[model samples]
Target: MVTERDKELIGALQKGLPLVRRPYAALGERVGMGEQEVLRRLADLRAKGVIRRHGVIVRHHELGYRANAMSVWAIPDERIDDLGEQLAGEPGVTLCYRRRTAPPAWPYNLYCMIHGQDREAVLARRRELAEKYGLDQWAHRVLFSGRRFKQRGAWYRPPQPAPEKAEVRHG
Candidate 1:
């Protein structure tokens, strides 16, 4: 069960940690908790499965990776697990995962993202990966992103209150 204080801590987390040498200390100050207390509470939350995991959203363009391509494949269901794992471990592959396919429209199920400084490099890397992993045997497509959307971590919202019980009067 989340206490009121935990909610306060979560609120601070939703704002994103402040960029400082002692970020946890700063975060604790905001939540009216000490650094160690904050850490302990976070650890407890993780142990209890209240918090799943943490991740970073990188700005690839700013980091000189201008070309971004999402290479999707229609791998056979039986072979998808092995191939997805192999492709995910390849160099230049930033992200990889499986998704549900919409047949007759979109048949791609397995997806991997690769970023590079230019389109040629990204495409070449994709081709190499496909040939090296025998991914060319499967139908696939490389879709280059034309624009980037804003990215941020997950947001937490407060739970709504239950409705008050209605009292019925009897004559």
Candidate 2:
């Protein structure tokens, strides 16, 4: 069961947080808890699988990595697990996951994110990955991010109170 304290944390996350050196301490003050209590609860939540992870979200593009691509691969069913782990071990590949491949429509089954200084650099790393994994026989593609819509921390909240509606009167 979700407790009231959980709801409070969720609410704080949804409304966003203040930018300060001790942000958690400020958050604790608002929620009637000390900074250590806040940190302890967060740790407990993670241990119980209530939260996956808490970390900084970096903007790769802002860091001069202009070229970003999602490189996907279709590995033989038997080799998927081994190959995925191998690719994940690569330095430049940040994100890697196994996905279903819809043949004739979608041929890539595994996905990895590669960010680099430019297109040429990204392509070069992709080539290195393909050769390292011996994926010449497998079909693959690099899908670059044309645009980003919404990227922010996940917000957990209950149904919010709706805004007051204006009354309409017929003349």
Candidate 3:
């Protein structure tokens, strides 16, 4: 079970650090903690793998990356590791990993995220990758995100009962 402090720390991390010279300190002030304590708790959470990484989540489109696609590749099961590493090392390829292929309807195992300023640029890069890696034989598709519904850090709060005052009193 997470302690109350832990819950607060999770909330803070989920919301994100404030844009300031001493952002943690500002967050700590809001939650009745000091900057050092906040840092300590963050370190502890990361060490335990509760937090994978602490970094900014940028708006790619706002930053002029109008085209972003999830590119899936059908790589041989035996060569996934080597090919995944190679794909990840490529410029503008932000993410790459392997997933179990879905039958009949979906048949891609390897996935990578590619971002560019426009559809043509992204497609051009994909073609370049296809040629460089001899991926023409492998089936692939680029699925662009139609809309962004939720793109925030994980919320780690547990359910709570109604506030005692609200439960007990009537105006």
lDDT of each: 0.80, 0.75, 0.76
lDDT of 2 by residue, 1-171 (tens): 556676576556544455789888988887788989888877777788776566555667799999888888888889989988998899888788887778799988888889899988998999998887787678888888887895554433445432222211111
Evaluated at residue 65, the lDDT of candidate 3 is: 95
RMSD of 1: 10.1
Runs in model 1 lying further than 4 Å from the true structure: 1-4, 46-56, 149-154, 159-171
Tens digits of lDDT, candidate 1, 105-170: 999998889989999999999999998989979889999998657444334564523212211111
Clashing pairs in 2: none
**Candidate 1 accuracy as lDDT:** 0.80
TM-score for each predicted model, relative to the true structure: 0.80, 0.79, 0.80
How high is the lDDT of residue 59 in model 2? 67
Predicted structure 3, TM vs. truth? 0.80
Task: Provide the lDDT at 18 for model 3.
Answer: 84
- CA RMSD for every model? 10.1, 8.6, 7.9
